[model samples]
Target: MATLAEKFGLRKASGVGEAGWGHTLIVALVSLIYFLPVLMIIFTAFKPSAQALSVPPTLSPTSLFGLIPDQFVFTPTLENFGQVFNRVMVSGSAAEPTGFDVFFFNSFFISSVSVLLALVIGTLASYGFSRYPLKGNDTYLFIILTTRMLPAIVVIIPIILMFRTVGLSGSYLGIIMLYTAFNLAFTIWMMKSFFDELSYDVEDAARIDGSSEIKVFMKICLPQVVAGLAATFVFGLILTWNEFLFALLLTGVDTRTVPVAMNQAVSSGGRGTDWTLLASIETLFLIPVFLVTFFLQNHLLRGVTFGTVKR
Candidate 1:
């Protein structure tokens, strides 16, 4: 008994035809629960010290009601954010800039370059595996998947030593390559699934029309899985962005990343953490990630398909 408009999602009603109040309520509750810590970081970034670490903590009780209580009431300040920015921007070594700009740049550069490289290469590898009848390919894929299962701790020492010997430690090229290696396992598998979802007819037609193999791949096939690529790229970017262990172990002054710098702040002199400053940096760190995910969410959820291929 639904209208055409409702069926197409162009129009909605309050009850069964559209998302009901119960569904909306469930989703909201789950989102709030999942994002509660992030909410804390944002609100705490604006709270003063005495208020931030008060006996009960300003944001205590953690319920919606508690968030609106008198203790949560405070004059927000930018002092903490300013302090951290100044700390990052001005505190660089002559040889290895230590400023906020350097850390931000290093993180952005390494993650961006590595993810792009991984997307290009991983998708190609996935395509090859999907289209070709190479023997033992499933076993090969399983091995590749196993690489992702290895604990980072077990491999850290070897990676560190290898980088040190090659003089790649602390270099952009080094981190980018290392990240590409780490990301390949997941990206390859993910791309393979997406490519498999498409029929081989498009590529075959292109090839029959005298298109080269590369052209068939680039022009005929890649376009159909755009949504999958976006999702994979987002996944790869997040892995690289949030990477801490290798970045910390292998990188030095010149190439240290945000996560490393954040840890250094908390570890400095063993004094208790700088709460306000920590919260401020955390909030700023969240912006790029949030925007990327939000923009790509549509593509990620619905994905794309080139209408059904003819038999």
Candidate 2:
């Protein structure tokens, strides 16, 4: 009788092939290690307080020995979600009007507006740079990059002074403008690379066919760079979403972003350190970014590598 191994063409002495079982085992182990923290987070997100905080944490339901009261039976309640949405609980153990809803909306508004402005400004700058060679181009690029390198704290006073002079301080417009300015450097560099890789012949052909320059750009060039746009949108969204210092320093109560609001939630007295609530809010905040990456990851990879190899 042939054994199970024999049925699968595995012999006693097939050792160290590139496609060997050992390689498969190693790959599986590496994947598990990389995913462990995420799995733990998912578990904690679903757990009740005692389960979430249990010392020598139980990795599975069976570890509880089914001894938990039915009241605590991992019953998923939307109470925390309700709290996050319905009311911004105030300081103390008692719930107050924390205004997280306002913060969430502000974060979305700031991120969206900044990304739109960035793409527009970046597209123009990148197109110009791609079409024309400027003197001291390397120096210009470095100077632009340097703008991003300046410490946020170092520029806060100048920014505050500038905003104060213009009556933009602590306003949504102020923070959105600040984010757009800061994000523009990177956006231009990335989009310029994309534009440089594009075929000039296509645009030339369009010109010969009597298509205007603007038409060529709108109808021909833009289609080829859709992936670049998606990649840039993801970058700008993430930068704006996680930007805490500028949002915190530049905006007042009405314009606080999720990150700043989350931080502020912690200093609201005894309830500030509610790890469970914090975890939940963090988990919620992370979902949109995750979905964006998951959906656009293929396009981003392809766009980023578009011109790297010529076959």
Candidate 3:
């Protein structure tokens, strides 16, 4: 009987026995290298402000006698996180709130709504293109893609002017609209590819069973492309959440997103950057994206490779 590894065509490293320990060691090393910066951020987030800026950075918490420089024996504290959320005491009084909670809400709302709008509109458009071909369908797709190809900076001036003329500058709606527009081209192209890869047999069978076109799309076709939708939503959310230029230029203090707030938090009051506080903010900022990716990891993996395999 063929072993599992042999059946899967995964051979052990030559001359290294059947365990592939050498290959496993190499993969572990590469993963560690990739995660080193994230580990540093997390470590710094728990350090005191002074320790975070100490000469020759140390990964371990600082001890009174300072254990060996490389030893992980320092004490951990929540001072930085307290400062990030304005929960720290200042001069024996409760510190004023920093409004970080508002920034987080703004980022979440804008990213979620923009990605959903793009997904809905793009999915319908993609289905139309895939199922109902027209004389210039390819040309239309290329045109839509060209919108994404343009440098965002190149069109910022005109967009700013248009938003101002429409009295939409600095409003949540304005930023959300811009994000949706930016995400639309990517959504359309990606979803269209998935739809194109789907066989027509299932859809045709549904049509023959007295299903309306809309019913066929809603009940049959949409379910088949769920992985693709998940992948597109995650990418679009990341892009909009991290967008700095548009948020900086178009949003007011009341509507500012986390990225813009992070920049201000770093240099606010011109008192120099607080490395520990910055790390704390970065750690918090990573949570939502991490959670979303974690929950959707299986779908994301399938979506990315959906069209590559052929039966």
* Residue-by-residue lDDT tens digits, candidate 3, 236-302: 9889889999999999999999999999988866678888888999899989988997888767654
- Which prediction has the highest lDDT against the true structure? 3
What is the per-residue lDDT of model 1 for residues 106-138, given as tens digits with 9 covering 90 to 100?
Answer: 888899899989888999999989988489999
- TM of each candidate vs. truth: 0.86, 0.79, 0.86
lDDT of each: 0.80, 0.77, 0.85
Which parts of model 3 are misplaced by more than 4 Å? 1-19, 61-73, 87-94, 303-311
Which should have the higher lDDT, number 2 or number 3? 3
**Candidate 2 residues 1-311, lDDT tens each?**
76543443444454234487888999999999998877666555556666667665646544266665444345444456555555545435555666888988898899989988999998888888788769977777778788778788887878888888998878998998889988889889988888888888878989999999899988888777878988998988998899888887789889889999988775565653665566667777888878987898756654433343355
Candidate 1's C-alpha runs over 4 A off are 1-17, 60-69, 88-98
Model 2 scores what on Cα lDDT?
A: 0.77
True-vs-predicted CA distance for residue 288, candidate 1, Å: 1.1
Clashing residue pairs in candidate 1 (N, C-alpha, C atoms within 3 angstroms)? 88-99, 88-100, 89-100, 92-98
What is the full ranking by lDDT, best candidate first? 3, 1, 2
